[model samples]
Target: MSIHVVLVHPEIHWNTGNAGRTCLATGATLHLIEPLGFSLDEAQVKRAGLDYWEHVDVRVWPSWEAFEAELPRLGQPYFFSTKATQLFWDAPLAPVEGTVLVFGRETGGLPAELHERYADRFVSLPILSERVRSLNLSTTVAIAVYEVLRQQR
Candidate 1:
């Protein structure tokens, strides 16, 4: 099974690193869209990946347009956001080989345009507490990836 975890305009190096680790663990490819806040060579990123960074099948794209152009060939695309009404569990998150999970920046869930463009593709993890805003980027990635894996089995 092939899974693709995409982080668009990701800001935190640590979250990226942790996401990379999760990707490596699950044999999923990691794709990052640029205008990133931190450099990929930073120590914090490597520290979070914990020596597994080198093994990660990571790809970096210059812009969203660049990545969007190749999205068709990647897999079935799913945009994750807290604003979505559809619960992730209710979505057709199966056939792991044909899934590409896209997440937005930590500060902002997803670009307003993406929500408009792929309105039906968006899915959200449930948040019971009103106090909690959203899940951490890395944590969200891990949960989504594992859900895909679970369906595969």
Candidate 2:
């Protein structure tokens, strides 16, 4: 199953650029929901290199509501959160299948209610540092997305 990466209210350009590259490497679809932090053409993003950008498969959704409406209709499964009890390493992921791996903004992460609602589907990458609150946005997505691919394989 292909992993879909969703970023809600993303606020950085380089992070988005790195994420797109990761998706390209992993064969995942990158989805960005507005409002975004930088103009899509920001120069900082250009640093990630044009080659990866060319191969990156990305989808833009106008709003969160629009994404929610389309996700189920398209039969794409999703996992949301960084601190979820379920570990991504253990979650059932498949190769060549269509599933989604959703992430929130780097600043605050997902809303409490959204976390509660998707609790079952949520999967987290284990952190050795309780002192370290979270991971880099792109880093987290890369880790989780690959785990999904690993499981599926």
Candidate 1 lDDT over 34-152, as tens digits, reads 98988877575555556878899999999999999998887888999999999999988866447999999999877999999999999999999999999999999999999998888
lDDT assessment of candidate 1? 0.90
lDDT of 2 by residue, 73-142 (tens): 4444556566688877776655354777788888988768777777788877788887988789989888
Q: What is the lDDT of candidate 2?
A: 0.77
Per-residue lDDT value at 80 in model 1: 95
Q: What is the TM-score of each candidate against the true structure?
A: 0.94, 0.86
| Residue 85 miss distance in model 2 (angstroms) | 1.7
TM-score of 2: 0.86
The collision pairs in model 1 are none
Pick the TM-score winner. 1
**Alpha carbon lDDT at 16, candidate 1:** 89
